[model samples]
Target chain A: MSERVKVTIDGISVEVEQGTTILNAARLIGGEIVPPAMCYYSKLEGSGGKCRTCLVKVSKGSEKDPRPMPKLVASCRTTVMEGMEVQNITSPEVKEARKGVVELLLINHPLDCPVCDQAGECHLQDLSYEHGSAATRYEFDRRSFERRDIGDKIQLHMTRCILCYRCVYVADQITDRREHGVLGRGDAAEISTYIEKAIENDFSGNVIDVCPVGALTDRTFRFKNRVWFTKPVDAHCNCDKCSGKVTLWYKGEDVIRVTARKDEYGEVESFICNDCRFEKKKTSDWVIEGPRKISKHSVISANHYEQLAPPPVIRKNPALKEANKEQFERVIRY
Target chain B: MESLSNRKKVLEQKPMTFGEKIYLPSIAKGLAITFKHIFKKRETIFYPEQERPVSENWRGLHSLKRDEQGRERCTACGLCALACPAEAITMTAAERKKGEEGLYREEKYAAVYEINMLRCIFCGLCEEACPKEAIYLDGPFLEADYLRKDFIFGKDKLVEEPLKS
Candidate 1:
């Protein structure tokens, strides 16, 4: 440990390690501090400073002191200086600025949280509750965008995107086959491919994982249910080289979903690949496709024996002729 | 882009009246909306420790499924790979041996079934295309990725776990 530096967050003075972020330091000294980072993660290996929620006021040594760094700095991406002061609770200017930022984000963000899959787990919901203003000044028709299916398992909803470029950055870092990038500028700026090309890499699904909100989600799970209904199971992703623990989700007894569980932030890269997230679906009718459409008087017998059978295995020796699914048409159900 | 000077003016701002300066009417209206939300149900969901429920129609991150005997249901039929508009799935089908018949339900099984989840569109087309009833549309709302490679869901990563006796 290097020299511990003294810093003051509000009036509580404490000594934290050198190069610690304000967010981490604040967490260490507990209070009602409300600074947030929609895109900042301390253990995160990458720096996607796209989300601007982490801004904070840094007054100099004294309350009357004038010479200080920029009035606001991103608490997550910025490191703590020796005697620096962070103001998240008492500063009116900073609070007003942050509230404006949240308002702008809500301008384009679909207010579909009522029915969205991310309703219960969304950062927007939490941030608004913490710092967003009670009113929105935007009354004109908000911009709308078509869905961008970047990969087979990932669907992109430009409407929900706050344009935090974590997906584009992480995708480039992994594939070296740079297929996705943010385009345009300011409010119009967005995460998109060079030519709106489809994402074509083994790690395409990670973009969906990194997205802070429901801007990108699995198409299979589109509008299926609210996120809270599914209980997470502490299981593992059984991929070829990695079979790391997965935060498997269960709705009732059925393993309805899976995602990488972060036991240690960035210590173990989420040990799952696109193949594991998708290939499993190739063999079983495990996910109950909503309820079957039956008349009230319909007679049916419950097959308890089939339900009692063992849970399905996720891996198989890759074999069989590749199905030419191109000829298949999308069956639209009424 | 043309500047406003070059464009025709549509609307102009007028000086505020005494009522506007006081803003009592507007303040009352704003308070009404705020009061509604204050009295309405809370919406935020704390994550990692707590998450909301995933509805039947929610499209989320993907995962592979297994059969009653613990055999991977994926036949490596490659329908998912083929059905994928994003061209995300890949596979190498293998013939099952006589002695290892129990290992696979079908004589022809997928020796390799991998989905470039990074490339998957999650259109649920793979679920639509599979004749084996192996695949389905269901999973997590959020996919957390540390490395770009971790987003790639492979066989070892996607396979289901063994049942606890």
Candidate 2:
């Protein structure tokens, strides 16, 4: 086992592995400092520093060095040093920097949360809720692009993309052959399939699991039902390429959507194949275990199970009836 | 005693003429007035078949409006449901997929929009609160139905016919 390094995040000290990133070190303390790392995936190798929302202020260096870094460093990429002091959750400067990063990501993003299939389980939505400003300072027309089909199963809405490149990394690492990659530059950059070839790889559906936003979504489950209304139950299927442990989003008795089951830290342990994600949607196809413990921020659970108040009964007014009768008697001399 | 003396005396000396006593002239005068109205334009309209012109500002049954591009304008934001004082409106929103741009005006469209006509009071608040101008109260009066369930207007009944390009 490697030697443990002690790190102080927001005055809460914790001991983590020697090569652990500051984001993981802060997570060791749990609730003290939660740096929102949009582009980081624990399962993928070298998976962060793309979205700068995880920037933190380092006050003090390790035992070997006495001076701290001059500027804010990305916690996802920066390693924890011995006795290093980091501030992510508490520092106003770090918060402001994260807000700026989130603002930049949202510049060209379409704010259509109500229609987005990823709204209930979206990482960007949660991060934006925690660290984003309500109003935007940008005054120019938002850049828009025509929606593209990445493969037979995946529909890509380039307008809502934040360009975190998690899908590209997942495809590169997990799949046997890479059929799709990001093309273009800057504001025009997008994930595309080469020569319009359909992504027929077995592990192509795992890209949907890695997407932090609605840029890449499942075409079959698109707009069928909101995620919150459907109860996510832990399910499994018999497949060769994957373990088939997936979450089936059930709307009543019918399974409406399927996704890889994420851990408590919001990371998928094993990437499931396309057959498990798409083909085996039937409730009969997989064994359903139990209901998914929906987080408080989930849009599905927000108002899903609450009992609607019964419609109020309309009552007839006795006084109004008597007044009407008196008026009738006065109108006709009866 | 002085106030009692100032009270007006009840007159009892008047006698009616023969024609007035029998009341034939007064009855004939009433008949003449009734007969005169028959020759003039009729005020009452024939039932069902011949309808009267409704006022321009008449608030009647609700109808979901369509944009000029023959697409549904409602994004299903639930603002109309919130604005409904009678709690008559309910809807489920869905994301508009590709090749469906010709059907929905926005990315978010109502998959199932229903308004309980039995519960609606035709207050026009929903129409006024609509930001997209997708709902209006310009439809004719809701027809009477035998079953209560028939009073519930779904998207099929509320949505306007798509404008032909």
Candidate 3:
């Protein structure tokens, strides 16, 4: 239990525990408002305010005498002060600024939404709907970069990078096994490997989640299906022993995708190792296409499969038939 | 004879016709040529959105090589920097110590290798110059920025994982 703080966001009054961020408190009194958090990992300690996506407006500041708090702040980093009022970052100017930032990111972006696996569920796409311009202003040619195979497990599209240090920051801060880091500066600065090494962490797949866009995607799920068609059903992960809640993406009878479900425990509290999160590969019942057949033995074509049966059991003499063996043995023994 | 040739040009040039004087037909021909080029297969690869295909010998974004055991193969012999014509490459070599056997496959390695992106013309000189095929320029050519400092690509960007068979 902690001290309670009362705050109003868009005329909705709510009381929340102290030390909770504006993002957490807003969740208490549900609203349609959404905060943008870049370079802020809920799991990484002291990892907020890097990209400043979670900006909010505080109308009344102090407990005694309240004035409007700073119109802008990194909500993921800022804690709830007593009697403070938050706007939930819905200002028109804020929208324009965020749009500008996203535009800058898209300037060099390959915009391969059709081919990318994370198109629909991507945070970058979500933000664009709420905070982006209609058209881009970059008249010049964009920066083109080929696919970089940083690790065997992960493929990095350098052109898709927004210069957010979340991947490397989380890698160094939380993973303790840093296989990635930012290289170069400004537009040239990108997420890459240390001397072309494979990212061999047990939890490397989380990079796919931390990435706001499809810059990082599971090599296993490449070009499988569009993300929009699947349904995210909340479930528990059965990887090892960790009971991290996971969302199973359902398309028809199949589970196409699996991801770490966000929870009340926060990103840090929910400790899911790399091996546990590999459940993303867990697929469900498939809807068979074309002619389906059941065969008992070997198949014919080049696409044939063979099924083998168990060998016959060995037999041994059971008790020498009957009592006739006993009588014969008695004579020999005597 | 040169004076007679120069004077002979004026004799044939008599009067300008209506279509020739208007210059409309010639302008239309020029416009058609421009339109043909617009629809034609452009040699320009839109860049950031579309990358140009790399020739087999084309040097691109540098990537340090790895051995079969997943160890770096750079001996850091300063050969690449020496061969660079633009002198864009700079390196600081260090001798391998005892326990770093798994870290670096080779004995000598670059402590620091940087290429000034602004100065580099992608001539592939540095790559051709290297005794060991450590530095390559195959891809991920970055976008142009408003600032000069952003173009300085460091070792972190240059490093890449080994190609899968």
Candidate 4:
């Protein structure tokens, strides 16, 4: 086991193993102090420092050399030192820098949340809502690109891509074959397949789950319904290729879309195969589990109720129960 | 019993006077007041023929708006439906195809936007929740219907007519 190091973030001290990044150290203590990451994924290897949303200020460098760093550092990329003191939300400089980073990320990104399928669950949407300014200062025209189909099952909108390369990393690491990659340079960079070749592999569908934005989305669930309108249920099927564990999104009795189960950090618990994602949309395809619990803060939990049990007062009073008969019936229907 | 509020009033039953016992004078007074109102201005108007003025901010029937280019402005993000207190709004979205740019404003639009007048409280929450400035409660009052199914308004009734240009 690696040696443990003590780090203080936002005035709270937590002991994490050595070589652990500052973000993970803060995540161990887990609360509002944890920095918001846009690109860095704990599952993917060598994926950090692309998006600067997780920048934090180091107040104290180390135990032996107790000198503060000159500038802010990316928390995901910067490893924690012994007795290091970090400031995330407590520092105004980090907040201002995150706002600027959000503006830059939204520069080319279109204001198409009304049409985008990932509007309710998009990480960029959450990032901009918290850190971004009300309006843009950019006077020039925003960049745009025509929609392209990467495959028959997955649709790609290059305009919405933030160039985080998370999807690219998924292709390289998770799948056997790597078909698409970032093309062009600097402002003109885009994720594209060479000669528009289709990305077909056992785990190629994991790219859609890794994408933080609506740049990549399931073609089967395209424009079917909004994310909040559909009910998410935890389900699993027997598959020979990949993990059968998935969340089946139900519009009604029919399973409109199937996706890998995502954790609290919005990362998939286990990547599922392409067959489990696109082909198995019926309710009989998988073993049914009860409704998945979504956070009350998320828009996806708008109408979802955790417990359908009637209030005790309703049982005591018959008049109140009579007035609330429709609601009780609706709860039973759900 | 003692009054908690000290607001209880006591009434006395007194014998009638000679003029009150007769009742002729009081009846005549009531007839005179009734005749006086015959020359006064009528408070009620013929509603179908002469409508009363509504307030500037009055929220009436909802109408889906259209852009100056004759395209439907609604992209159907479902915010209005989510914000609806009465749950009157419902819609299904569809992607706009090629050569249909002139008809719809965005890439995805509401294929079947419906609002049940029977369920709607007309609180204007849907108008407030609309991001595209597409739905507004600006039209005149909704008329009464005989059939219950007719109260469920669809796109044909809610959408405003396109500009002639």
Best model per lDDT: 4
Off by over 4 Å in 3: A69-71, A231-238, A250-256, A262-334, B1-165
Please write out the lDDT profile of model 2 over residues A81-180, one tens digit for every residue.
9999988777899999988998898888878775678876788888888788998899999998887787778998888888787888887886677767
Can you give the DockQ of every candidate in the order shown? Answer: 0.01, 0.18, 0.01, 0.84
Per-residue lDDT of candidate 4, residues A102-128 (tens digit):
999999999899999999999999999
Ranking by DockQ: 4, 2, 1, 3
DockQ of 1: 0.01
- What number of clashing residue pairs does each candidate have, in the order they appear? 85, 1, 15, 0
True contacts kept of 2: 0.25
Question: Model 1: per-residue lDDT, tens digit, A1-334?
Answer: 5978777887677789988778778878865674766776543456535577778788864334545766587777767777778788888877888887788778888775533455545677767866787777888887888767775567888888887777766776776677788778886877787776777776677676667788888766654433444454454434564454455555566555556554222122463666656555322323323332222221111111112222233122222112322212111221
C-alpha lDDT of all candidate models, in order: 0.64, 0.82, 0.63, 0.92
Chain A only TM-scores, each candidate in turn:
0.73, 0.88, 0.72, 0.93
**What is candidate 2's DockQ?**
0.18
> In angstroms, how far off is B125's CA in candidate 1?
38
* Per-residue lDDT of candidate 4, residues B1-165 (tens digit): 999999999888999999999999999999999999999998999998998999989999999999989899999899999999898999999999999999999999999999999999999999999999999999888899899999999999999998986
- Compute the lDDT for candidate 4: 0.92
Every model's Cα RMSD, please?
Answer: 28.9, 12.1, 25.9, 2.7
Every candidate's chain B TM-score: 0.72, 0.77, 0.68, 0.90
Model 1 Cα RMSD, Å?
28.9
- At residue A168, give the lDDT of candidate 2: 83
At residue A20, give the lDDT of candidate 1. 77
Model 1 lDDT at residue A47: 58
Clashing pairs in 2: A228-A300
